[model samples]
Target chain A: MLDVRFSDVRLPSGPGVGYKPQHFNDILKNAFPVQWLEIHAENYMGDGGRPLAQLRHLSERFAISVHGVGLSIGGEGRLDPEHLARLKHLVGWLNPASFSEHLAWSTHDSHFYNDLLPLPYTDATLTRVADHIDAVQDAIGRRMLLENPSSYLAFEESTWSETDFLHELTRRTGCGLLLDVNNVFVSAINLGYSPQGYIDDYPLDMVGEIHLGGHDEDTDDHGAPLLIDSHGCEIVDPVWALLDYTLEKSGPKPLLVEWDTDVPDWQTLAAECTRAQAALAKVPA
Target chain B: MTTQSDFEGALLDANKPVPAGLSDGSGRPAGRRYWVYRNNVAVSLGDALGTGFPAISKLVGPQNFKNLAAIFLRQHPPKSPLMMHYGAEFPAFLEGFEPLKHLGYLGDVARIELAMRQSYHAADATAADPTQLQRLGEAELMTCRMTLAPAVHILRSAWPAASIWAFNMVPGSPKPQAKPEDTLITRPEFDPMPHVLPHGAADFLIALAKGATFEDALKVAQSNAADFDLGATLNLALGHGAISDILS
Candidate 1:
């Protein structure tokens, strides 16, 4: 197979919402200010369904971004050829403006855990992750944006920081960063670090898309603050503050408001997009 | 460097010790963080199962259901990224699980729910026109093979599986009687409907799905139930748009 490169679109300066099925008819019936729409790549992998049909309709109007959650690009094993082929088929059919996946692994030993599992940032792991990303890019024939993970813990053996690791992946694979701001806040607070410092170390110039989502705050063992990337509720003040802090440096990018669990009505989701748009307006695109 | 398998095995099992050198980058053990990951994986997969089999979850209660779901995830993790297709083997798993032996009917009820999920994601097919069957000659109709919709499925059980599922799922439902029942899943619209498959109608539909001609299916159905109401069964299938084609 030829290793052809497909240039992905740099999303226009605005905000979009993670497309939810509940809001499909509403979106079709009424227009919202959300300039683009993003969907999880795994959800539409089925042969034929309302999801794909809705995506086909939405793609005609919005700048579609295919965000994948099940790629397992950071797993130790090579990327699953079957999953890669499905993704390739989906991307080929959709020709999405932006394609992205997580920097975490969700599969091992042919069984998908269905949750983003964290990884240590060591040289060997970095090499393996880079190779996996390269394979994904080569298979899809399009450059993908890798989103940083929201983790509750870190590894002592991890020699490189998360920012440095992402920087390395970007340099080696020539892929762009998704720069999930909510994940930065969740991980930094959970790991007892400065979200600002992490953002500073991040190669902001390489970020092609941004994500903002809600988080659930709780206390882990030993009474330390722990935040779960639930995406179940409204965006909190701290996460919005982190998004503001990020946009001030990274400027306006293609941002998305993701609320997957306990999804509210279209108006409620669009309200989050409005908030994102208002915030983006502050950052002079 | 630890293998991915080592990390995932620890992540899935809460009792397992974290791999060596796994820390919180603060010179402390990563035990708590590892538990957090473990909880995430178990809870997410549990939630998926709970969503897929709501009636079963309700039958077992939330706490017991959650524990069973956690155990099930460890035993049979998802193979596909599509969560819709996650628990195909769950029915057999329930049947073999010793703890749930007393509730033998639970596995059959789970089968009904699984059939519903499959029907929801099945290929879209146009319902067969009533005229196609009405115009068939007597001999031709008897020899014709009924092509069922991809979203159509029939589940037969010795327990009142369909009634139990409906009682647990819907409000204001009548208490289920301890009688054998069968279910027919048909997705005539966006949502899949699980209808009680009147007596031997399930056997008839099953035979048709297996490519048996109308005559053979009716014979088998009659063998199963001597007084099988062919008119009622025909009305049910035709009314629900379960049949998508017919071949003479």
Candidate 2:
């Protein structure tokens, strides 16, 4: 069998926060409890700027994780060579502790939509996503992590279950998974599945990192609860509970708290990191 | 069409019904839920444009700006995934849009904002040693060519675009007068600032940017305006670290 399993990643099994420039000074002063930082790859792909300068400084002190938002690993077309080259350039220079992208496709034909669109989990999609993951791993010469999408709806054409598809992706491409607990909760509510059941079936052994973020609650046409993965506010109580549930099974992993929109003050975000630290503390590493 | 084609086609067009295969997990049509994807595509791209051209958004009120963004995104969807590079064609779009043609300055103002963004993200370069220019004799200095820093940008406009930008973006600034102006953007530090260039300086910088020798660029500046002040122009460029290299 081809060795589909990856060795342990370099990130420490502690709390990390998505690094925002607004909290740059605060992080420099006292990044206590927060062990690492994750940055969106597309934001720092510029040739030179304050973003790169701050990143260069932060990488010296913290294990930087480059999380890409633009690779479109599930796009039906061939992976964009120019975007792949850009990703390679960034990874080559930053040498981040880990790199990951989503299981969503945001581009179609020549247009790049600024949203992570859902994909049907069929054999064709599985093959396409696996090929793209292989291309990314080959381009960057490192095992990449694929994050699950928070869906507001599902395609009836999907044959494989989401967890099964993710496992098969790891099996074929040797890429690890970024198990976003918040996404799991959101998808559970929207798709009428048990969040715990989803996590139970998840290939936790293949998970390299865990992501927790906030979601906005609404109703579908039938008044069923619909959750939009906004990542704007604090992780709600239930999602945090989901984190505890995940940690109990997976043990300690590099936990990240992501607040992309309406980012809070440094102390506010730091408090979320403190909560993540507490969850990781419960599990024996 | 494939599932993606149908899904993506309906995403940007709110008028289109939900694609065939999607469900809200109840075996019924995904109606309001499908709007989640539709809203995400439009609103996020709208936010990117709003961030990229704040002055444009300010000039066009919030609701109008939102409407304009809806029309713009459908017409000129982003070619690249990077949000920072999203609105390269927006300035031209504003110029050609029939309803906004009355505000002739909007296009130029958009240009200023776009240039500021480019200056912010351009590659880093070290300023040339001022002592090199000081040590050289006048003849040697005139013969040498200079390279502008990667973050330096020159924008010429018929409207006082920089002054208008200042009045809108910076507080307590004087009102812009009705006159033509040229703007120079330079990143001496982390933040890039736009400066209203003196008369004829844009010509001089444009010449230098195109590899003209100092003497040749100086002539171009003087020819454009009889009262072109070389000392002041060089002072602004050197003070802002805009001159990256002096090739002998």
lDDT tens digits by residue: candidate 2, B1-248: 24788888888887888888788776887788889988888989999989899999889888888999899999998888888888999999999999998999999999999988988889999988877888889899899999999999999999999999999999998999999999999999778999999999999999999999999999999999998988899889989999999998
lDDT of 2 by residue, A1-285 (tens): 543232233989999999999999999999988999999999998889798999999999899899999888889898999999999988888888999999999888968998899999899999899999999999998899999999898888888999999999999999999999999999999999999999999999999899999999889888889899999999999999999999999999999999999999999999999999999889988
Indicate the residue-level lDDT of A181 in model 2.
Answer: 98
- What is candidate 1's CA lDDT for residue A234? 92
Q: lDDT of model 1 at residue B204?
A: 92
lDDT by candidate, in order shown: 0.86, 0.91
Q: Where does candidate 1 stray beyond 4 Å?
A: A1-10, A29-31, A219-223
Q: Considering the two chains of model 1, state its CAPRI-style docking category.
A: medium
Candidate 1, A6-108: lDDT as tens digits: 4345567798889888887888887467888899998888766466668888988888889999989988887889999999998888888889999899888
DockQ of each: 0.54, 0.76
Proportion of the native interface contacts kept in model 2 = 0.82
